[model samples]
Target chain A: MPQTIQQKFVHQVIGHSATNNRLASKNKIGSGSAPVNIALSKYWGKRDATLNLPTNGSLSISLPGLGTKTQIERLESQNQQTDLVSLNGQRLDQDNAFAKRVSQFLNYFRETPQTFFKVDTENSVPTAAGLASSASGYAALVLALNDLFAWNLDNKSLSLLARLGSGSASRSLFNGFALWHQGQQADGLDSYAEAIDTTWPEFCVGLLEIDVKQKPVSSTQGMQNTVETCALYQAWPQQANQDMQTILQAIKDHDFATLGKTAEHNALTMHATMIATWPPIVYWQPESVEAMHKIWRLREQGVAVYFTMDAGPNLKLLFLETEKPAILQAFKQIKILEPFKS
Target chain B: MPQTIQQKFVHQVIGHSATNNRLASKNKIGSGSAPVNIALSKYWGKRDATLNLPTNGSLSISLPGLGTKTQIERLESQNQQTDLVSLNGQRLDQDNAFAKRVSQFLNYFRETPQTFFKVDTENSVPTAAGLASSASGYAALVLALNDLFAWNLDNKSLSLLARLGSGSASRSLFNGFALWHQGQQADGLDSYAEAIDTTWPEFCVGLLEIDVKQKPVSSTQGMQNTVETCALYQAWPQQANQDMQTILQAIKDHDFATLGKTAEHNALTMHATMIATWPPIVYWQPESVEAMHKIWRLREQGVAVYFTMDAGPNLKLLFLETEKPAILQAFKQIKILEPFKS
Candidate 1:
């Protein structure tokens, strides 16, 4: 009997001893929680699509309060042929897109043909609104799985498993800053995120929600299109890698100006590559542009506020605690989160 | 006296014989008119700023009705020590920014230190509103200069002179389709635009005016900033050159699909480079983003409409006559013009 490529990769990360422990689990209920992360240096353009290996390294900051909570338990009856999944408080049908994806991920962990899991998940943030629920969701799920099997794998091992679910999920395993290393390998065993271990107590993130609806294009598909069709994208991986290093240095030095400027530039460059794509993926709506202009105006008026955008139209602002009053006055609806503070 | 680089280039284009004619002329009034041209493949970076040599070739379509009309004559008295410039019906002060730029350009053709010109220019389109009035203004001014001196120089020679004023002005020397060659010479003698000679009568341009006020940053400065600070801009010149050939081929083949797609992608890529620049150059307003979404929506509904943007917020839409009804229905304020038609 030969293990699948994914199984081989998983086994390599957790070792053959842990692989054996998976079959020893039966009906133990395990639960875990994780936080969403906003990328300061974005991850885009995968080197290996199947393995979700990024072409360049990325850096992020996690919001501790806004994230996902999940619980998992092995099904007791052999008659249950499929995994039962629920979101928030409602049970999701197996045919649901979310359930289907979760089931596919669970396939990597099934001990036997008759083994099934009942998975319950809840998101503190809006799902699929580019708050990166999948990052925290998959991270929490991997932790739950780790607890269920009693593998006692370290955070790095759990991050590797989380990355197999979503590329950004690797960064969500940590509470503060995390750096996802873009490993130079074919098998992608080295590609995982670890905590940066630096915390800026004054650092703040302001979420300006332009739209909560599902994005018109998924980041996965948008990145693929950009990598395939955007000629300007040829320079992105190099710039992104450089930005990652700059951001890491900024975090270590506690240089807010360098960090804010580099993060904003990195996000804009990522969006630029998407804009240069053939079908032209423009995530900016009228409100998005308006928010950008507002940010620019505030900057012109001597405010130190800067912003970074994801694959969706929402903007996540970066500013120190000193500018909180100005940012609050300017954006009345902004949801402010202090990442480093309790 | 040693000639300036500009004077030497001008002499090389018009010949030493025309250089003498420029000096011999005194009081003859010369008038010329030219249409503003919209670039299908944008000219963004410069290899030589002194000679206005571009980094890549470009393609454009001339708007026959929207342009500049200019009249020029040498000052008869030595008391008139400065070039007197005016726009529309108002006489501009010698210290005005527009007058200063024009006088600076006219210095290349000055017969002597005391030589001066009275220039009156009128633009049918909005000045500095991203309508490219500068392209047409420079082209008409060059033509008026040629007429004043009775140089009898061809359009190619005139285009060389106009390019010294503004890079896009080289294409404005011809109606219909034109291609500006990105010459590979130290002196920039080979960099001139010529008529493409293939016209699609059904080709239509719809102007979506987002703003008519003065642009915050000039295209000249914006191009320089992008070239200098944008890391992603390394791939731009090659993509722009390739797009030039593709657009030229599309014009010859009368393939509207290929032409529109390439032109829009080129424009977006150009903007992408600017966006990736440090201190990011964003030309889109809220209305501009709204218009872009509208254009994308129209395309999703099977309309063949596409748009191109310059360094300002306005959009120049491209579509065939068959889609005119659909475009008109979509954008009520849009002003449509046919390049090949009167």
Candidate 2:
């Protein structure tokens, strides 16, 4: 029988020995958690949609307190004919989009036709609000699978598996800074994220939530639309890759100005490509623009703060801890997070 | 003495004969008026700053009854060492930016260093509000100059002179539809706008004034910055040329869908290039974005309306006469005008 591309990829990662070792005991429950990450250098276009390979390298910082926790257990009962999935404390129907996606990803790991699993996941952050819950959700799920089967995969292998679920998930596997390589291989084995080992305690992030509602268009679809229609997007991959290098160096040097400026520019450039697309994808709301102007005004006033936006209207502000008082005064409701601190 | 590039270009347009014929008599007060035009296909970059030549062709529709009127008389009085200028019934100081730009433009027309002019201009529309007042301002000044000198020059020569004042002014010389050709010659003699000749009587324009305040960065500086710093701008020239072609064809075919869609896309693409630049130029105010969302929502609801913006936050909405009532219902503050009707 011909193996599906995903199955082939899973086999390549696990190898024959690990594939044969799907755990002798089905009684164990494995639990894992991961933090949501905001990309400083964004991963925009995809080279391979099926394998979730990005066209450009991306760097990100994980928000320590906000993410997802997942617990996975084998369903050995004879009555369990399909995978059971629950989000938060509520069980999700098989046809629910979230549940269906989880089930589809699980298809790669099934030991046999009758083998089933029950997955329970909880998000500390709002789902599909451009906070990248999927990044942490898939990363946590991959870690749980590693623990449940006693596969004991290293971070690199685990990131590879998580990337199959969501492209940004590769970066979510590591705390603090992570760099996802835009690998050259068509097989996509080389394209995975690794920890950027440097930590600056003064680096601070402020979340300004304009909207927590589900995004109108998913990042997966938005990326495809932008790639297909935006003329200006032809310049994005080169710019994005260069930005990744700049940001990577900035992190090492602990240059907040370079990092903040590059991050803001990268985010705006990504949004520019989206706005240029046909049936233009303007993710910014009125408040988003207002917030941008306010940030610019603050910077003009000598406050060293900058912001980056994902595929939605919310903004993630980057600044040093020294400017926290000014930022707090300006944004009354902002939720500040320190990635370096526990 | 070697002539400046502006003098050479102006001399070429007016010719040696008109240069000698700066009117046998200076007593005549020449008066002229022009309508402000909004570009359907934008002219964003400069090939020649001295002669104000554009890098790409543009198309525009003039809004009649909403522009500038001017009267000019050569300052024969010895007391007037500089050109005397007044705008909207108020005399401007010699050092005022507006008066300085006007006096500087008048420099090309001086018969001698001592020959000065008294220029009085009135704008029914808000000045420097992204309503292209400079377009009408230059066109009116050139028309007044033509009349004052009894140049009897055809519309084409007048357009060439108007272009020397401001790039979009070339299109402002004509009513209804105008196409400003992006010429090939280095001397800039071929770079002039002409009437498109075809008119759709149902063609309507709606003005949504989000802000009438002066733009922070002028279009001239904005274009220069984008050209120098924006990577995405590399793709703009080709796309703009293509969009100009699409819009020109749509105008001829009276294809509202093609025209509206192309114009809106063209404007957004131009703005996208600006946003991609370093120290990004974002002209959209919070209210501007709010207006855009309202327009998009109206379009989604089967209202065939599209909007275009220039270097400021104001929006020029495009639609047909048939959709005017619906548009009026949706946008209570919209100032609607019929181009073909006037």
Candidate 3:
């Protein structure tokens, strides 16, 4: 017979006051928020797998208005062996890596082997659209767990813990420019996040999602292949380090030209590294290349817009909020995006 | 009823009495020695059609003991329309571009009209290899003409004339380390060759002729495509300027590391620019990429070797003569080179 740990905790807390009462009556509730982060400098490879340490450092900006709202509650139930997790009221299996990592972390402090925990998450941001849905999702989970357990850990500590789950998840803990320092330590204990500048609330990043349907190779596998097979991967570390310093300085000086140039070069170099790998891989679809060219042509024609891409086919155009309509109009002219425009 | 204005000069040059005796004897004598030049940086684009000015700068080194030897003898002929041009005693039509250009230049001086030139030529270099046979061929022709006419013009002046025929031909005039500066001026008159550190005789370049049957695309068309469409070409001017400065300094300092790095980067950047052009052309064959990787791997394994490619699939490995056998062995392992072992 499996002794129910939740029943034991409840019995110890309320002295078996209501045996007939549902286990949901004795649950703990918490709410948390997470922000969407845009990577200023992209990270493409991993240096260490066990700790999820990046080969190159990256910078990101955490947006204020867009994020995930998550709520979690631990319930006492008659069902003991079953682990139930729900996202926005939809049931989720416990086998998920993200959920497993979270559950493992929780089990470390609880000192009780609970078979399962239910997590309810609501993502306000678009799911899987390259707007960093995972960033917000993971961030909200970390924050919600922190609130439920009354853990007074700082955001940086939470970020370090979150990094073990997803590399980009750490950036969402802060609402500003975040730099993930890839420390050269064996244990990766020193690797953590630091802020470059507070988020520019007025600055808006316009995303032109081209509605790509195919799933991309996960970042973990893609990066591993590049690191192992890319002839140019060894040279990338020095260049990326130099670029990081220059881009940080540019951001500090508000030098948009330098920032955009660095971003574009870094993106191109990343793609070059991919091509240099054995059995060369390219993230580019025809539309992706065309979109880049269009953006470059528009910029050359005096449009004040610059574009950046993460590990997806969608392009993110950085511009002033006032320039949004014009940028949208230009994107609409592209046939691929025409289907998506209202 | 057209008068032959060149009767006096042609009689004086060939000696009419000797011409009549030669017709009876059927004997021919050829004059002048012209060296073949190989482009080190590789010329692959044209800037001006009329002048045959290159879009980007090219560098070349003269091949010792190889090239075409030709002799031209002026003959007085009564035929006004017939300009007899013979190569090794066979007559060639004067309507071709080669003949037309040469005749046009000669006519610009108004030195002689209605004169038939008997030409005899022999080529010692390997024909149709990526070894710049055309460079040697055209260079020889220009030098032979200059020598025959007693033009009193130096090799630089001769190269300017040669540029009107082919771009790579212009780089062949100098003995070592020549640069073809693509002058920004419209007339391209200022565009000429300059020698960099003519004293570096210790440095030697070896050609590993990976023979292929087909001819590569002409450099003139490649450059036009690159200029019209390559986004990376915009960065080339700045990069090339920096590389030129570094390479010059390295040659002066006798720093092999600097020389090798600059050369490798310049070659790789050139190829990168080529691929970035619209419709994506690649000078690299499977063997070429394999050869590059082999050299790179060898270098990583502590071999002192570097490589550069011209406008074909064949590779040139620049290394000390003593290390040539071992490097060739390494290339053989990759199946890039055939067994050359004795």
Candidate 4:
């Protein structure tokens, strides 16, 4: 009473059809929005520059509406032509630096594989003033391309590609709390971002802009200088790792004070490493200093708010919705700083 | 048969004569000038707060002619009624904080154990502004009193006494390159400052004043806050030790580059620890930030100047005599910063 060959053939057909159904769904053009993520536990150094493997793990959160939207479509032309790219409705010149980086990123797919594509992206975030516009921009590109090319890569695999474009971009794939693990492998096969939670109690990030200009030294280059010359540079990875764990625990335990406190400490430590570098790259403006004191004043008043900054003049204030009114009122007194929601 | 009693008595007579001659030299009322010493490798934390024993060693240089002139005279009466204290020729109240401190210091003198004395001091340095006026101020008082009271206290023992009043004052006991060792003792008998060199090639220090007001939190209290809560606090002692060694070697080797680089790094690391403290005691003002950038800019222009700030708003710039014209010309551009020789 053994099963017949026709029955086995019928079972294989069922499995093949289900697989085809999933792939076919991704056959058409696709678009997605990837929000910009702010690192509460920052990622600074790299273990492998070529593979984009971080030297330490980091934790970040996505500002739900502050991000980029990218639309991508596979071109039918098979002449091995370049991927046509347009940013903010402008056709980027092939010789433009950003366009070249975008094309190079597209080439990373299968290493000279035969599919040309078109990419269009627009951002709702700041460009280079350290709000991490590139993070959200590249994250949107990877997501849209993953959908259009039918590569069927999972979110983690897509994150690996996103990191090649920008390091912080890897964490932008997730919605709420995302952690990019600092993998030890040379190939960075295990280094990727994962979503911790899709939602949390609605939290608002107030951006106190000090300057909106591009820096002379980019964050990547600035970090390279820090790694080479800072005497305290050797201590960053271990401290950041410990900070990541403490922050992660704070998140799990639902302790906002511990979370905010650790976030501020971690951010300051990151800047401390920079300031210790020979010729010490200082990014803080005079107004930024005043703004920080104001935040401290707010905390002194028992306002349950904290602030962090990246490699730029803008200070990001993280607090719950309940504390917004007091924070807003306090910052309003400062003539220089404009507190805003993104 | 080794020696006759007369021979032994002769040896005793010579010793007594030498001691008498040393004390006899201070037959009249005594007055002296002790220049203020600025720490290059700063002393920030204390192991024994009551004794003013630093948690780490420090190195400093004394500014000649920029200090206090203290005059001390023993009273003729047996009243022990009051030790008159005057600053800048104005008699201070008996209940004044400084007068109380001076009386307490006089209590340490064993030579005039029951003697009430009068003390007068005048400061040419910025008091309580981190230019270390107290360092030179207290140092002058101790040196003058040590002479007038005929205590026969060596400079080493006197340094310990100065530390009881102010920590950095210990270094002011020496002329230049004074080092205060952080000793591991409960009573702090072993902690004292020693001279590395009595004199060196004349070097100038440019004082960039940020504010002349007293700080809200004193250095002692600020450091306590750092030790209690800063996550980066533990790494400070080890980093400071290495920096001290490197800087000490640089001083011996006469390598300005190594000295300047390590000094700047060491100072920033200390601030890093403070910045990580809960509620983070930040001592830097906005102009301080600008002054730091200007130093980096000056170095980029091939100048060999370095900066170190203690727990105050003034920044001390150390450079050779050759760089004076160039530094003065550069600082003239900033109106808020008044750079001057100490």
Candidate 5:
């Protein structure tokens, strides 16, 4: 039988995080929010399956307006410790796939034996819509629970904990650009994401919703399969590793052209790995492809814009804020778009 | 003004062939045939646009029965020295795209400014239908003209000549598996295809024609665009060079699995390079993706089969002869398939 999460963590927790006064701890509710991360270098496969460590290093920008707000409330005493997860105000079944995965991560945070908490995760973006909703949700939940237990852990520890929930969540701990290194450590101690404080005032995100529903194959599963198979992916690691350097330098220099090109290519590289896998995973729709082509056409007409996609058909168009009007005009020329400012 | 091609290669032709009795080389028709080669590792971008040299190497197998049989008849008389080209019984205008390309190649074979020949090309493969008809058609036309004038050129010289007409046409000169090497020379003199003559009797080609229309972007234009852009392709040359060695060894070792995996992966890599281009050149249709998935699914069920694609949406599934029935049954399961045994 599995031990209670508090007992599991007592033995597993690393040094330096001292517990607060246990005697004074009482039932309380705490709310925290985290923004969705828009990956520039792209996080695809995992290196450590148990810890959810990434296979390739990545850099991401936080979308301040889009994310999840989760309220963690300590539940009343019950016969059995059971964590409840509610998404968009609908109570999900405990045995359902999403709830089970959430519980798996939550159980590791159980600080009190025979104690449970209710997590209400409300998303500013569509849930599981390839907008990194789970990354924000898990990051927010971890943040809220840290307050509930009075565990004032540093951002690194918080980021690591978020990774245990969703790999992309590691970057959500930071406010701006964050780099998640593909660490060499087997224990995942060195794998946490670090925030890059620099900001570009002109950087803007253009979200074009080709579809809002969840992808056919989730990013986690897709990455796992691509890593195991896909021969073209044999070069993806070295390729992306070099791209990271280029994109990082571009970002530091505020070179929008170089940054946009590198980011766009890196996303395609990730998608290529997915497409080269057995059965050839594809997330592109006719409308999505059309939108990308229109963007390219707009660039030909002198619009400074580029695009990146995760595991879904949605496109995240990155451009300078000054080009917003041109980008909007280009979008107007394209039909079937439901745009949200990323 | 662009100089006529005859002036370009006048000194390059070897002098071994004394024209067989100048009087006997009259208006009699001569025929030569060559098989269409199916690329396992695809050729996408061009390193030298002027010489038609590919940026990446590719491996291919021949479809012997599906090819072109052209009849070359020396013209009785002509004042300005013209090469009238006809395809599939249609007398194509000299200024038409295909005819112009053929004329450009035929001009290189002109022994004298006044020498002229009429070329009639017939193709077993579909014309401009992604069936590589131009490859076979050009190969046969070049072969027949070589016989007509008794040029007695070696296969390397013939392959180079064919490439001037169409890039992939260079491979069709071979009887079995052929590898096209993207040589390092700037002048493209060393860039030519070599025939790997080993025959795998068990090897079979399952052709599925998804569509026969002309590609949205011609192969030449697409390759030039990809080589100019697609940042992910920065590593493609090295990746493909390595794949070339592995695939060549697999062919020599008769390792079908290694050959299949490398070929399939290489095709995807080529497609990735295209997809990563500025506007993203995509060739896949819904049915084409469905066909690829069905092939992968068949493999999961223990059928030793793999697939490759060219610039168009058609699929060429490579499998052992022993698994033909199983492969056909799986194809039957795939809807919208117009199967042709190559």
Candidate 6:
């Protein structure tokens, strides 16, 4: 076995002179923060579950200003137990799925290495509220590890590594708009992330969080059920690919109307696929439908607000910076949020 | 009101000696027969319920060999108690929706005439099945009346008359292929039916009636619910219009591939709209999805067959005349139909 270019790069980044000596270093910490991403084109079903590769391509915009901050530190004084993870100041058990996913990805590189690592993460967004909190969390871990190891991997390779942990997390690796490449290879090695363009940035997303008490269906399980049973899921790959292409062109052209149309269609298609599944499931609450109708009616009345949801009741209304006030006014008229009397 | 050329022609065909006589003879009855039409571009919602006008246009091909035979008889008998109606050899109560619809349409022309007439109808197709039995029934009544009165009404005029009773029935007024004209009028007077110039004798439809005992949701109520609740219903009208145009062109060019694609997409969109409705009603029986998937899998495996379904559990497999034998043979191999030979 010879040292690969990636391995050499990792050693150099970590200031190590030799491959064997790399593990002997005491500093195993990584990046301090990573941003959350909102999927402009949603990722629904997976082609390979183990690899977390999607059936169709998805594009997302990383919200650099709003996401979780995480820190990974090697614990020399801690017990032989592999890792201790904490989320927003609360210690999480090692058995937790999110923590386990992080540990698993790290274990891939350091075979039989000491598992004594401490993870401290703080989420800026609401947990389990449909706003890609896990995306930011997993992305933070991926970025943290890459920085800690001095792995000089590009966004694409980091995305590939992050995909094994969570599908949407791969999209969070890049800033602005990112597209998850649905690689043709069987091993999913080529399936990664790339920015659509650096210049396009007028896109602004407003989170209208409907704090419903009920928990919605998790995307991972919901999509898996849909893929396994939904008859319409068979048609989604082709339609999603077409939508991705159309949206990519629309994004490149800065056509908000086309982007909005494509996004709305994609969202409907996703929900339709869910209901078409056997033992039909619905993630929508009654309020979700109400909010959607209100937004739609406002749009029909010539408001420039577009709404999208990801496996939950909360709605994210996308609008231009200039149109935000009008959209917020319309939202207030519908009594969607508490009035700010200030 | 001055009689238009269309009204005069209708009067001449209905045996009126003068336009005034035709207008005065309010109690005159006419009977007509038109074939049941299966939609290539399906209509699922109403824009105006009182006029029975559809939200979108639909394309259908009349089944020449099968339909309803209707007879309308004018009566001088003024006894309200004596207006007996019979359908398919069974005495139908005057309060029955179908009978009431007939009476109402007649009353519209008579406007408090001296007498009322009884209508007798016989349906050749299976009633309450996925097939458009009502389309034939209503079309037959309109056509039979036009013939009995010696009214020289064109297919379009008769279709307009029939549309006042049922939206889809209007499309059945023409033979071979037909299009329902969805005019943008509040009164719906301009909406009628027109014949498409394609006589596709080479095309054949094979019925695979998966007899389910449960009564499916009525298209009328289902469509109303969809309009009032389903967010996706808004897109149906636009897509249906596009599909109708595409299918018409496909029929004209004898392009089975394009025709099949358009039909499949239209059907799927209709079903998707249904699923999006609140309370999430599904007209499909469990076996219907299985049957469709079976045929789809076979088609994917090189069988030249496509399936379309209405608001019922039964499936209609559309295939080219030359490929019917092979398609039927493949269908038999799957044992989709049991106890009956393919």
Best candidate, DockQ = 1
Ranking by TM-score: 1, 2, 4, 5, 6, 3
Residue pairs that clash (backbone atoms under 3 angstroms), model 5: none
lDDT of 6 by residue, A1-342 (tens): 214333332333333343344355444677646567777678999888767778999887676566778888776773656778888898888899877866766565552456467788898875644577777777777677666655556677677766766788888776677899888877577788787775454566767666564444678889999888655467677767877888899888888878876776677667787755543445555456556666666776887777666786667777666676777676663212211110
Model 1 DockQ, alpha carbons vs. true complex:
0.91
What lDDT tens digits, residue by residue, belong to model 4 across residues A1-342?
A: 113332232123224443354335555776767988889999988877666678899999877677899998776677747788888889998898778878767665422356677888898775543577889988888778667655556787778778877889999998778899898766566788898853446466777767543245687888888888766667779878888999888878777889898898888878877776666677876667777877887887899988888887778888877887887797763212211233
Write down the lDDT that model 4 would get.
0.73
The alpha-carbon deviation from the true structure for residue B194 of candidate 2, after best TM-score superposition, in angstroms, is 1.1
lDDT value, candidate 2, whole model: 0.90
For residues B82-174, what per-residue lDDT tens digits would candidate 5 score against the true structure?
Answer: 778888889898789888887767666555556677878888775534686878887888778667756667888878777777778889898
**Candidate 6: segments with Cα more than 4 A from true spot:** A1-165, A168-342, B1-19, B23-29, B111-114, B332-342
The TM-scores, one per candidate, come to 0.98, 0.98, 0.52, 0.82, 0.77, 0.55
Task: Give the residue spans of candidate 2 off by over 4 A.
Answer: A23-27, A127-130, A212-215, B23-27, B127-129, B212-215
Per model, how much of the real contact set is kept? 0.90, 0.74, 0.00, 0.34, 0.18, 0.04
Separate DockQ for every predicted complex: 0.91, 0.86, 0.04, 0.34, 0.25, 0.06
Least accurate 10 contiguous residues by lDDT in model 6 chain A: A333-342
DockQ of 3: 0.04
Tell me the whole-model lDDT of each prediction, alpha carbons only: 0.91, 0.90, 0.61, 0.73, 0.74, 0.69
> Per-residue lDDT tens digits of candidate 1, residues B84-120?
9999979999899999999999989888878899999
Per-residue error for B248 in candidate 4, Å, reads: 3.9
Tell me how many residue pairs clash in candidate 5.
Answer: 0
Q: Could you give the interface RMSD of each candidate, to one decimal?
A: 0.6, 0.5, 9.0, 2.2, 3.8, 10.0
Comparing candidate 2 with candidate 5, which one achieves the higher TM-score? Answer: 2
What tens-digit string does per-residue lDDT give for candidate 6 at B1-342? Answer: 314333332333333353345444444566667777888889889888767778888998777667888887766555664456788888788788777767766654442455466788888776534576878877887777666555556776778877766778988877788898788977566778898876666787776666564555788888998898665566678778988999999998989988886787677667777765654545555456556656666766887777667887677777777776777776562212110111
The digit string of per-residue lDDT tens for model 1 on A256-333 reads 999999999999999999999989999998888888888988999999999999998899999999999999999998
Error of 2 at B185 (Å): 1.5
**Model 6 chain B worst lDDT run, 10 consecutive residues:** B333-342
Candidate 3 per-residue lDDT, tens place, A1-342, comes to 213442232233222322223232333765678877878777878887766788888887776667888776665675655445666667666797655655654443232465345677777666645676677777787677666655545766677656665788878888767888878876566677777753343345666666563456667788888798654566666667766888788777767667766766666666665654434444454456556666766776777777667777677676654566768689763212110121
Q: Which pairs clash inside model 3?
A: B45-B223
